[model samples]
Target: MNLRLMAALGAALMAGPALAAGGAEILKSQCVSCHAVEKPANTSFERLWERKGPDLYYAGSKFNKAWLEKWLQNPERIRPAGELYSRHVKGSDKEDVVDESTMTPHVKLSKADAEAVAAELMKLAAPEGMVEKGAFKGEKVSMSMGAMFFNKLRGCAACHSAKAGTGGASGPELYTAGERLQSDYIYSYIKNPQKIDPHVWMPTLNLAEPDLQRLTGYILQLSASEGK
Candidate 1:
């Protein structure tokens, strides 16, 4: 073989390991500085305040894979102010320093890398079935009724909105929750938020089954409409 061809093969061989490293390895090297792959033992506000990013222990259950893949490439700020901890703190002695604090944009991942990372993340699921009987899948709340519940009855609009760039910025945008999240996951998380994420700012509504079904149905419809 020609020397030129041999050099090219040698370079390709050298680059193989990095390109072949799996998503978990990529996450360990690139993402662990800011994110956690395991559930935190301490769920206190103070403990959460020390975290640089949201935990990824249950990313598989919490986010849609397509959304996660797209988000990794075209990153957007989910929490406008920052994580719950950064947004609530009042003084300069705050411990958590998030991307929002530095005004740094999220690192954009290549499409292939994003897909791999999302696939790895989706492997992490809740140990048990957290949703109760998967109630919201068949609930029949009308759009108007759902709107009433979201906007007035349940007061969900106080922190969450039906569309992007329209609702309160503190919480995540729910305009696409139906497409972005699993229905049962929503039911489970809202039913007992602490069970999934301890010390989260979201309160345990302890809603009755009917209300839970109605609210979940409303969110499903709202997300389906894309806030139209």
Candidate 2:
């Protein structure tokens, strides 16, 4: 994978909701500064970072439990361009002073605490009751529509990739999008981009609920989910 593209994907992943159960209070104290428990709109990334954290409203919908646990225990060396605690760079640093009035301290996670938090965190649910079970016909229609949506409406290819026929400077490459995202995750993102980044270039256009569904369906199907 390309370095810049990976960076874009890494940054994009940061936009999702995080699951940390026993860590819930930790979330309440340390994480909620950016994430909105109620809905995704309140949590555009840029907006949340302002208070010193990224919005984790969609954690239930986005992260892998094990990865999140490890991340909490030892945050990755890689830092998102505008991360709230970038000044410290990694989990060991103490220089990143969080304003108590705005953000909370980065308390270390205990094994039991991390597991409990991960279990609860994974339950983050979205209202997709209307979406029928079983995969929709994708391959062609989905890929094409996803491309169109990314370029014209959502403009995801921007910042993420140029092949979508539009261009952005900051995001990642979707060249193999089919190989990356899960359908459930993609659909939820289209419904609300703010959950990922309350203020990233990705905007929350007032797309009709159904249209949002289709967009997500298409994106989830953007890459093949098998034989990675």
For each candidate in turn, the TM-score is: 0.83, 0.45
Please write out the lDDT profile of model 2 over residues 1-228, one tens digit for every residue: 999999999877764444322366665775565555545544444454455544445556565676567656755322222344343233325633323343234556777666776666667654454222333333334556656776777666545543443354334334433334345555545555544444544566777755656665554454343112
Q: Please, what is the whole-model Cα lDDT of each candidate in the order they appear?
A: 0.75, 0.51
lDDT of 1 by residue, 199-221 (tens): 78788987898788888877777
Q: Candidate 1 at residue 185, lDDT?
A: 80
Choose the strongest candidate by lDDT: 1
